[model samples]
Target: MNAWNEKYLQVSLLWFAESARNKADPSVVTKDDQEAYLRQARFAQGFIREEEPDPPMARTYSYQQPHALPKVQRAFDRTYATRGTQREPAAEPFATATQSKHMDHGQPTQTTSPLAPQGRSSGQIQVTGQWDKTPIKLSFDPDASGEAFYQTFFQWAVKRKRGADLDRERTTLWLKASKATPDTQAYDLELKEDELEELWNTAVEWIQENKNTKAPHLYATVEMEAG
Candidate 1:
């Protein structure tokens, strides 16, 4: 089972032993039960104690290494040439000009790129990506507001069975895209919660129309925010 369940079991057993000892006369205490309780207690304490000495070989391990990542070509195909700039006179498929203004999360400021779309439209897209090397997928209507989309993602992530392992405050969602490459350079762009609606709509539009056969699929990454 999981670590939590194992710890809980140990704790429960320890409590049972302690209660039995307190309620029963000293002469009635079983040696086995007392030993079990002491073992459980020690295990529980191990979870909190951090002053334990390091292994003899700890200092010998190398601590520095270059981070390596794949290099992707920077090109936009079948997607809009501009993002968040063109307003559709129809049912408002794109974020308004005002909305796009607040969405500055480290993207190149160029006005022409398939990473941006011409107008808004009604459709749905599938988002597939990684979280700590684990694949994850989610789908939602492209018509939804950026805020709504982010909320849906946030809820899905934090409600997972082992969600406690995620540190929400230091976690952020990013969309992977191509940029000038050293191969080691990061391509993921953060999706800020406040500007998410505008940013998401722009991304969704581009992904829906992207026609480059070799273009990377529009994927997301649940990243631990770097200090």
Candidate 2:
């Protein structure tokens, strides 16, 4: 009953009508035929006439184990503080004294705040506030009420500190309403594919980095609800 299935049904019906009208051929598709009926239909009808749409995507929830994420490599060199330049034992007693060149250990720079996330970590995370300006805001359609559900979820996130948790880069959150059809934010939610992909990808990458960091009992989620 996903959106893609509905589309396939439509295409099959179309092909059946066309074939019957033209008396192209008589055929029956049995369960054991084990052929892709939709593909056959498309091939017969010339698929270019009607492009296939992306199907209703299934996004399931997940909880990530506490872990570390790889830090973003900075283009510019970063400097860090070192405890009193403890000189290593001289190669030779008469070796000329020389300062040690800092070796890159991929550590954060000295100026980096301790709490500043180098990667996803465990424990309560501190966060700041900010507004996310939609690139092109869409006017709310009261009749559909699809968008309203999304707004409600956003508000819930703010109230429940989901937004804060996400900001801290310590959690991944995906808000998807379970649907038998490809709603694409049509009835219970509202979002374009690009936006959805961005959200989904961001959460996925967050989960990946957290796993790499290997924090403890870390939280990663793909939350679904009956909208």
| Highest-scoring model, TM-score | 1
Candidate 1, residues 160-205, lDDT tens digits: the string is 5436655544666655433222334333334565555446656665
| TM-score, prediction 1 | 0.33
Task: Compute each candidate's TM-score over C-alphas.
Answer: 0.33, 0.15
State each model's CA lDDT, in order: 0.57, 0.38
> Per-prediction RMSD in angstroms?
45.3, 49.6
Off by over 4 Å in 2: 1-143, 166-227
Let me know the TM-score candidate 2 reaches against the reference structure: 0.15
How many clashes show up per model? Answer: 4, 12
